[model samples]
Target: MSKQPQPAARAHNGETRPSYSERLWVPVWWWPIAVAVTMLLAAEIHMGAPGIRAWLPYLVLLPLPIWVLLWLSRLRVEVTTDADDGRELRIGRAHLPVEVISRAAVVPATAKSAALGRQLDPAAYVQHRPWVKPMIVVVLDDADDPTPYWLISTRHPDRVLAALGLGTASEPEHDKT
Candidate 1:
């Protein structure tokens, strides 16, 4: 079969950047809710405060929520090629070489619970996000590596599979024997 061209993004310099990157950001709706909740908490702390204590709480506590939300949304998933042209999948701080990826399957939203609960192996590497439903399960072939596979949470599973060159292996885990 002929090899298909990989999806790429244009770099800032207008160069063709070959990589797939996705950030697991918190939903936009959560921002206002977070700010509202933080304000309520700060208001409660401000009650009956003497002088600067009232306004001090607002100044200090307000940024706390924003900082926390930004921090929580920092998880990123990236697939990039190395100097040898081998692909690597980086999920958050963890990195997995595509060469060792024996099999990969997209776990649908319906089976996410079971995959994370019952079917999950204790030795497996899992990057889960409650905001994201669908996931990609990558089975490893490295004997030296004790980890069996990686359960990664991604909003675009199809694109992730395509980036990893596992587009044809997008079958669900339960479908296989």
Candidate 2:
């Protein structure tokens, strides 16, 4: 699947635009499969049916799968500057202030299973997608907050780290030892 174009930041009247933005779209191959399945189901409903019954199923069922896929693809990840909080990482509906981020690292595809499995923290905030192999782990230092860290799936882990200003600055704890 071809990567979708990253959204370009535009400056308007000194407003701070998002430094990084990505929509976690489903794989391109999934679209055809979804359409085919919906069509097959519609065909089954249309079998020997006359007039509106045949057309109605197609009208109703056809858009249903497409709508579902589109809705699922709407999940977004963004890094933007906030007047009150400096920089903030936005994932879906949740936002994390950069100031609270104590450390960050890119979790390679090989370590992903372990990261999400045994090493996973129950108090962590995780936004995972199987289609996305790599992820960013951002450890939070806010003593008041119960969440330990954030495990977020991303196609471009390096870019996410850079956008968060953790690239080359924060290193994985395992590497120090």
- TM-scores across all candidates? 0.84, 0.84
Clashing pairs in 2: none
Candidate 2: TM-score?
Answer: 0.84
- Model 1 per-residue lDDT tens digits across residues 37-148: 9999999999999898879989998998899989999888888765456777877767777889898988889999999999999999898989999899999999888899
Predict model 1's lDDT versus the native: 0.83
Looking at model 1, which ten-residue stretch has the lowest summed lDDT? 1-10
Q: Candidate 2 deviates by what RMSD?
A: 6.5
Top lDDT hit? 1
Q: Looking at candidate 2, what is the lDDT of residue 35?
A: 95
lDDT of 2 by residue, 1-177 (tens): 112353333454343568899999999999999999999999999999998788887898999988988988888988886444367788877877788899998888999999999999998889998888989899999888888899999998888888888884344367555
lDDT of 2: 0.83
- Candidate 2 error regions (>4 Å): 1-11, 82-85, 168-177
lDDT at 136, model 2: 86
